[model samples]
Target chain A: MTPALAIRNVSHSYGARKALDDVSFSVPPGSFTMLLGLNGAGKSTLFSLVTRLYAARHGEIEIFGHNIMREPGAALRRLGVVFQARTLDLELSVMQNLLYHAALHGVGPIEARRLGQAALARAGLAERAKDKARALSGGQMRRVEIARALLHEPRLLLLDEPTVGLDIKARADLLALVRELVQEKRLGVLWATHLIDEIADDDQVVILHQGRVLATDRAQAIVVAQGAANIGEAFTRVTGVAQEKLSA
Target chain B: MSEIAAPAGFTFRQYLICLSGVVWREGLRFLHQRERFISALVRPLVWLFIFAAGFRQVLGVSIIPPYETYVLYEVYIAPGLMAMIQLFNGMQSSLSMVYDREMGNMRMLLVSPFPRWFLLGSKLLAGVAVSILQVYAFLLIAYFWEIEPPTKWGYLTVLPALALSGLMLGALGMLLSSLIKQLENFAGVMNFVIFPMFFASSALYPLWRVKESSPWLYYVCEVNPFTHAVELIRFAFYEKVAWTSLAIVFAYTSAFLVAAILAYDPARGMLMRRGG
Candidate 1:
């Protein structure tokens, strides 16, 4: 079977600086893939390309077997994205934001309401639907973004640091919800984050460093192959940077 | 149950819907900030009522082609006030763009499935609608001041002209917003654009009057797109069509729109810096 998301030799650059250099990868249908990288590792750049925010300078990206560059509209319709920045409209209610997004995608009112409610329920934000998005707590606002992303029931989901500013429980809750989404909805997920704890043992992991993919494998296998006690150590070995150095 | 195949491609309807959605969002934001609407009307209102009153005695009314016989000083400056509303509205729309960037809503707009041009165009259209509203309000207030146009049909002609001029100025604002890196610099730039573009054009005074001051400045005013815009509105208010002014406004609108799109292209590095 063709992978739900396929990226082939994608490269991008900012003036005088290479943000993503000849990167290639694929995620099988219904699989959860974790993109691990440090700051400036080009993970966000890759996400931007996949979401069609920035067109790649070289190589092709396919969404559900559709070429992203040549057939962007079709490819984009098959995927959903949750950006690192807070995209919710602060002045509007949660339901209003979802309805606005639905309208943008051409979803009718009835279907939008149904799908929006289901998504909010899944994200544990159903009761907060009528509340202004600005009035919600930071974690609640993040959940609203996740719910909004799922409103279209996309086959592929791209998340860029979804749990960046969440508390420990909020982060765990969000990750757990994402895992459930992958299983229940049969979604191919590309979860980009810099934290090793966010990657599970069975999850497919790709280690990116300096705009290049250093390694791609099962999280457990990578940890075992590096003779490391944890996924963090394996990440350090592959990326050639120690945890202390990175923190500093 | 049989499976339903997804469609092969997107349509212009999708683009239209996205554009409408963005415009609706801008309208809602404007509604939320009621003070902005009041301020938008009040600025032009003050100039029309107070400034025009003070200058009416000193400023001589000349026999311009668009005007029949001698026109009142307030009537003479009404189109300028309309143009002023559009200029300020255009800048106000971009202020929201910068605000959205800082508040993070602009990122949402950029990540949509639709092309960036449609998104930016929708924003310009919304600004046009707001500018039209302010123009009509000014017209009603001018009526109270006994400077009403000869016929109500004159409004129909003025609408399209205001739209074209609003679009041109709004496109310029979008281009500036993309080029300006910091919000602090916006005030300085606005002072530069707003005053020069307004005073240099035929907004407050006639081009012939400008000629008496400096012939070179009159040449610059003649070439300024704002002059054509003001001329378009001035002629329309008299129930006359100024084809030359329309052509110039349309030409400038097309150029500004194209430049705005190129400035916003994701590959052009402007958006990349913001996205990055």
Candidate 2:
């Protein structure tokens, strides 16, 4: 079967500085892949390329066998993206925001309202659907975003540093929610974050460093392969930086 | 049961829905921002009441297309002032685009399965929608203040002209927003594009007056696309069609729309600044 997402030989540059250099990766169906990288590690660049925000001139990106460059409409139809930035219109209610996105995706009113309300309920935000997005807490806002991303029933979901600025409980809750989606819905997920604790031992982890892939494998395999006792030490060994310093 | 999945390709119904959504969002935003509505009115009102009243003696007016005989300076500049409101409102939308691009609202719009041109057109349509309302508001005020009543048909006739000029100015704003990397630079757009375009044209003065003052400035005003926009509105207000002005406004709107679409192209590096 074709992978849910496939990125091959993708490279991008900003003037003389290369943001993503010959980067390649893939996320298989029904699997959770953590794109591990520090800030400026080209994680967002990779997301931008996959999302077709920035065209990649050097290589191709395929979403469920649809090439983003050659067939962006088809490729994008199956893909949903949640950017690192807060995107909800502050004045609009949660349902309004989701329905607006649905409209953009060409979902008619009845179906959009049904799907939007359902997604909100799944995210435990059903009661807050009528409230303005600005009235929600940061964690609730992120949940709204997650609900919005899922409203279209996209096969592949790309979330960039989604848990940022959330409390530990909120972050953990979001991670668990996403993990459940993978198990229950068989949704493919590419979760990008610099947090080490977010990656589970069984999850597929792709370590990116300096616009290049440093490693791609199971968490324990990477730990053992890199001659380290755990993911933290292995990450330090792979990137030649102290993990303590990264968290600090 | 079959799933209600998004179609594999784009569809016309989808495009119309998105365009309507864009327009709807603009209307909601406009309603929320009462201050913006007030400011949009205040700028034109100040020019109409104070500046035009003060300049009435200095700027002598001959019978113009819109006017049957001698008219007050305020009467002469009302259409131009209406266009000015659209111009400023157009730039305001551009400012919002820059803010939206930075804040990630633009990404949501761009990621849709629609063509980039359609998306940009949706944005222009939204801007035009908001701006035309603002223009009519200004026109209502002009009529109440007794700036010089246009023909009864003038109120209705000027709409298409307003829409054309609004789209032209709004398209120019979208083009600038795509090129401009920051919102702070928008002030420079005001100083450069808005002020120059308004002043260099027949907005506040007749082209003949400009010709008398400086032949060079007259040529500049004659060539300025905004002059044609103003002329279009001015003529239409009197139930006459300025064919040259109409054609010029149409052509400029198309050109600006194309340029804006090109600027918004991913290859151009306008939308994808690494940190911007």
Candidate 3:
């Protein structure tokens, strides 16, 4: 089977400043990949390219063997994105948000409603489906966004700093939930963040710094290779940042 | 991955469904925002009642319409005000686009499998739908104010003209939204684009009246795209179609829409300028 996502030698720039530099990675089905980078490390820029929010002029990105630029309709039908920023229309009900996303993916109303309800149920937000998105708490709203992204039944999910504003418990719960979905639904995940704690030993980690890929391997492997005791030390060593500085 | 099968490329039926969904959401959002509906009416009504009342005597009217005799200032400016509503509404929709871009809602639309133009078209159509409702409401109020159209058929005749003019202005707004870097600059857009377009057009004053005062200003008013839009609606309200105005409106819509599409191209750095 083809990898869920494949980025080959992609580079992007804003004017003279390069944001992503010949970056390359792939995520297999049912696996979780953490895109680790510091602020201004070009993780978001890579995500934007992968999602076709901006075109990558120098390289290519593919979703499930379909080139994004060549076969966007086929490639995008299987990809979902949860951006870092809040995307919900505050005035719209949770259900309305999900249903609208479903429609955009060519899902009919009846099927959209059915899948929306199921996604909400999965997110533990079925009870709040009728409430306006503004009425929900931030954590609840993030869950709704996840539900909406999954409404189209995308095989690959790309999340950019998903737990930015959530509390510790909420953040942990969200990570756990996403992990469970990766296993249960066999969904490929590209979770981008600067947080070191979110990286698990078994998970694959891609370290990007200043638009360049430092390393791509299992978290445990990186730790062992760097002669570090834990991923936190391994992350700092790979990205050339101090531990205290990283957490700060 | 095995849980959900990926569908094929977008089908025509799916396109229709997306269009309907977008339009429906716009309608629902409009209904929820009662202030938008009220303001949409109140703006034009104020112009029709108070502004026109003051200008009626100052602007002499000749026998030029389905009516054999001279008409009131209210009658001449009605279509102009209607087009003005569309122009403002088009810009308002652009404001929403800017807000949505900042808020991340635009990403949902952009990442869809459908073509970018289709998604933008759906949005334009939705804005037009709302503008149409607002225009009809204003017309109803005008009717109650004893400012009726030339014929019962005139009401229906104005629909296509309103839709075209709305789309023209809406496309222009979309282009501006794409080019504008920051949301705060939207107010600048109002001052530079919206006010100039509204005032310089023959919306409040007839082109001939401007000609009598300053031929240069008359030439500017005659060439103004909004002026043609207003003229299209004005003629339609009198149960006639100004073929030249109709063609000009269509041309302006096409040009603005094409420019908007180009400006919205992610490769051009507009969408990428703001945080996505």
What's each prediction's TM-score? 0.94, 0.97, 0.97
C-alpha root-mean-square deviation, each candidate:
2.3, 1.6, 1.5
What are the per-model DockQ values?
A: 0.47, 0.63, 0.68
Give me the overall lDDT of model 1.
Answer: 0.82
lDDT of 1 by residue, A1-248 (tens): 77879988987878778888889889987899998888889998898888766767699899888887777767776778888888888889899899888866667567788989988988888899899998998888888888887776678888998888888898888899889988987889999988877889999999889999988899999999999998888888887798654332
Quote the lDDT for A49 in model 3: 85
**Candidate 2: residue pairs that collide:** none
Write model 2 residue lDDT over A160-218, tens digit each, in one string: 99999999999999999999989988889999999998989999999999999989999
Off by over 4 Å in 1: A244-248, B1-4, B11-16, B267-269, B273-276
Question: Taking the tens digit of each residue's C-alpha lDDT, what string does model 1 give over B35-72?
Answer: 88888788877888899889989999899879988987
TM-score of chain A of each: 0.96, 0.98, 0.98
Backbone Cα, N, C clashes tallied per candidate = 0, 0, 0
Which ranges of candidate 3 are over 4 A from the true structure? B1-5, B65-67, B272-276
Docking class of 2: medium
**Model 3: lDDT to the true structure:** 0.87
lDDT of 2 at A20: 85
